[model samples]
Target: MMTPDEMMTLVTENALEYGPKLIAAIAIWIIGSWVIKLLVSGLNKVMDKGKVDPSLKPFLCSISGIVLKVMLGITVLGMLSIEMTSFVALLAAAGLAVGMALSGTLQNFAGGVMILLFKPFKVGDFIDAQGYMGTIKEIQIFNTILKTADNKTIIIPNGGLSTGSMVNFSTESTRRVDWTIGVAYGDDLDKARAVIKQLCDADERIFKDPAVVIVVSALADSSVNFAVRAWVKAPDYWGVFFDMNENVYKTFSKEGLNIPFPQMDVHLHK
Candidate 1:
């Protein structure tokens, strides 16, 4: 081993030899940080000009900035005269481990990105997906929020929604309302059809173009079932459905029609 004084001098010389590279790395880091900020700011301006969704903008900007800064850090490490090969290998290994550990979470993140970009649905839309039906309340990076018709809040993972089939009812301008009305077998089928047709004509919500269909649907043990189908604008669908039910009952009653109820004849064998 060398003397203490000799070792000290050698150590000082090594540090002096690498001192300029270290200084350069610091300089690059500081300048690159500012450059990254400037680039992120410019990107934000471009995205804003594109009129992207408000909720998606900030997340995209943040992810972009982080990626850029990570690349800049790698560049700085190269300039610092440090052995970057081992560092890169270690980083790769760490990333792989983390990715494996958080596979489910990463899937959700990817799904969220797809949702933001493609916009399969949006807030306030009444949707059915993954066996859940509700109005979307909010959408976030990991999950989506929903409010059920019964006023219950539901949180759904983005991964499931992104991969599953979804039905957005609110997107349609019109929907069909269907109901089966039962009448006594002895009642006049022709007059029942006329009365239902009159009821359909009187309803303003029912669309006139496609027209309404009223026909015998099935022969039940208790009565003859007549199916009534009408189309109405989506916004007025529920209202129209309830109103039609009430109107049909009243119309049948006023027309002296016999509404049938299920009956069973009981017999005892002794």
Candidate 2:
């Protein structure tokens, strides 16, 4: 054991070396936390001002805060003279492993970011994509949620949605509704056209300027088909179509028009 004087000298030297570093590290930690809070708040305001997607704002903020805090931790460790070379290398290796494991998820995340940025479709829009038709309920980080007409919920991954073909029905205010109405051969063509026009005019949802188009589309085996097309508001498309079909069924017979069906006659005699 060393003498009492030697012990006192060693202790004094050690305290001189580490005392200031500990105090500085504590002060830096406190200040760094406050700075991080401010930076995160500023990011939120910037995103809001820039009209960034609301669904993506939180995710960006969380990532920024985590990165800032990690940097602050490293700064504090460096102030205390802790060796960080091996730690940083280890961290990089772990990050690489995680990246490899979650490659698909990362792709989905990137897709989600692109979708949020470009905005091909928004919430409440009726869309057809990947053989599924539904209204967009929510857009998430890795998936999108849809609400079908029948009240079923569908979850689609963002990766495919970003890169695949999509049809947005709600993108337009008006849509053309087409139908084929057939009558027996030799029926009044002018009368069929007039009936279709009346049906279209009766519904206020149908457009008047474009005018209804009724023309002889084809001559089938048992009937002459008229192609009936009308332009109507998107919301009223199905309603007007169904109403027109019912009206035709009711009015055609009274108007002396026969709805025909195919008949095949086969004769075999001895």
Clashes of each: 0, 0
At residue 14, candidate 1 shows an lDDT of: 89
Runs in model 2 lying further than 4 Å from the true structure: 1-35, 53-55, 75-83, 104-118, 220-222, 267-270
Model 2: per-residue Cα lDDT at residue 191: 92
Pick the TM-score winner: 1
lDDT of 2 by residue, 124-166 (tens): 9999998899999999889999999999999999999999999
Model 1 TM-score (2 dp): 0.80
lDDT of 1 by residue, 215-267 (tens): 99999998999999999989888898888788878888888898989888999
Model 2 per-residue lDDT at 121: 92
Summing lDDT over every window of 10 consecutive residues in candidate 1, give the lowest-scoring window: 47-56
For each candidate, give its TM-score against the true structure. Answer: 0.80, 0.77
